[model samples]
Every structure is written in C-alpha cells, then in structure tokens.
Target: MNTEVVEEKSTKDRTVVRKALTYFVLIALIFISAIMVVFEVYEYRYDYRQMSSLLRNEDDLNAEWGRLLIEQQTFGATAQIGTRAVTQLRMYSPPPSDTVVISLPSTAQQK
Candidate 1:
C-alpha cells in the first residue's frame, strides 16, 4: 500500500510538470506573436504615411500643370496672337479704300 501511494504521487508530479511546460510554451508563443503583429502594424503605418506624402506631391504637381495650362491658353487666345502677329511682324489688314468691287452677271460669276 505504501509503494502504491508513492507511485501515485510520483505520477501526479510528472503530470503537473508537463502541464506547466505546455502553458509556458503557449505563453511564449503568444508573446512572440504579439511582438510580430506590432512590428507589422508599425511598418504598414509608416508605408501608408509615405504613400500619402507621395500622393500629396502628385496632387500638387497636377495642380501646377493645370495652372500652367490655363495660363498658356489665356496667352495663346486667337485674338491675342492675331494682334501680336500683326504688330510684331510688321503686318496689317488693308482698309476698305484698297478693296475693289467688280460687278458682273450672276450666271457668269459662278466661276
């Protein structure tokens, strides 16, 4: 009877040690997983911030391009160019005095 009790106590001790080791392993795994998750979250957030800054720069560049296009169109208007071309190139449009009016029969004027 005493030997049986001793064997039972030894088996119980072994079982408790195994349970403790298993819990320790599980806890360590959970801690490592939590650390990895934190690192991934930080990296993702940093990348997102960088992407946001790049997007802002692109928007700024697009806005500048739009503004430049508007300025170009304003300056390149047909009336503006016609004036500049005439004055700067020493060109002109003749007045009515230089125009000649030829009167002919409608049937013969078709050519």
Candidate 2:
C-alpha cells in the first residue's frame, strides 16, 4: 500500500508539471503571434504613406504639365505672333492700293 501511494503521488506531480509546461508553450506562441501582427500592421501603414506621397507628387507634376501646355499655346497663337512681330520687328502689311499681282506662263505654253 505504501509503495502504491508513492507511485501515485509521482504520477500526479508529473501530470501537474506537464500541464504547466503546455500552458507556458501556449502563452509563448500567443505572444510571438501578437508581435508578428503588430509588425505587419506597421509595415502596411508605412507602405500606405509612401503610396500616398507618390500620388501627391504625380498630381503636382500633372498640374505643372497642364500649366506648361497652356503657356505654350498662348505663346504660339497667331494673334500673339502678329503682335510680337509688329512690336518687336516693326513689320507691317502693305495696303491693297500698293500691292501688285503677276501671272506666269504655263510649262505647256513654253514647250
């Protein structure tokens, strides 16, 4: 009877120790998983910010490109060219009374 009691007590001790070890392992795994989740969230937020900054830069470049196109059109207009020619180069069109026209003979007539 005494030997049986000792063996039973040892088995109970082993059961308790095994249960404690299992609980420790589970807690450790939970902690590691939580840390990984935090890192993933941080990485996602960082990428989002980078993408937003790139989008804003693209928008600014597009706006600048639009403005440059408008400026080019304004400078290249016929009225703008005529005004610049008159003001800068002092050029003018002749009056109809001072103009003359001439017609040339055709190649067939020459042949």
Candidate 3:
C-alpha cells in the first residue's frame, strides 16, 4: 500500500507538470501569433500609406505632364514657329517667281 501510494503520487506530479507545460506552450503560441498579426497589421498600414503617397505623386506628375503637353502644343504650332522664325531669325517667304519644283524619277518608270 505504501509503494502504491508513492507510485500514484509520482504519476500525479508528472501529469500536473505535463498539463502545465502544455498550457504554457499553448499560451506562448497564442502570444507569438498575436505579435505576428500586429506586426503584419503595422506593415500593411505602412505599405498602404506608401502606396497612397505614390498615387498622389503620380497624380501630381500627371498634372505636370498635362501642363507640359499644353506647353509643347503651344510652342510647336506651325504658325507660332513660323512667326517666331520670321521675327527672331529674320526669315521670309519667297516670292512665287522664285519658286522652283523638282521631280524625282521613279525606278518603276525607269524599268
């Protein structure tokens, strides 16, 4: 009877220790998972902010692109270029009597 009691007490102590260890491991896993989730949420918020900033920059760049395109159109107009060329570069249109036409002979015609 004494030996049986000692054996049962030892077995009960081992069972208690096992349950405590299992609970400890379970709590540790839950804590680690919570920390990982928090980190992921933080990272997601950071990336979202960065993406929003980039989108704003893209919008600003698009506006600048539109302005540049308008400027290009204004500068590259034929009448504007011709007027500037005449006024700044002292160019003039030739008279009709000074005009000459040149013709290129086609290879098919020669053949």
Model 1: per-residue lDDT, tens digit, 13-88?
9999999999999999999999999999999999999999999999999999999999889878977889988989
lDDT of 3 by residue, 1-111 (tens): 999999999999999999999999999999999999999999999999999999999999999999999988987797788989999999998999999989999999998
Top-TM-score structure, candidate number: 3
Question: TM-score for each prediction?
Answer: 0.62, 0.62, 0.70
lDDT of candidate model 1 versus the reference: 0.95
Per-residue lDDT tens digits for candidate 2, residues 45-98, read 999999999999999999999999998898789788899999999999999999
Candidate 1 runs further than 4 Å off? 78-80, 83-111
Every candidate's lDDT: 0.95, 0.97, 0.97
Clashes of 1: 0
Error of 1 at 95 (Å): 15
Better of 1 and 2 by lDDT: 2
- Alpha-carbon deviation at 35 in model 3, angstroms: 1.1
Backbone clashes for every candidate come to 0, 0, 0
Q: Candidate 1: minimum summed lDDT over ten consecutive residues — where?
A: 102-111
Model 2 bad stretches (over 4 Å): 78-111
**Which run of 10 residues does model 3 get worst, by summed lDDT?**
72-81
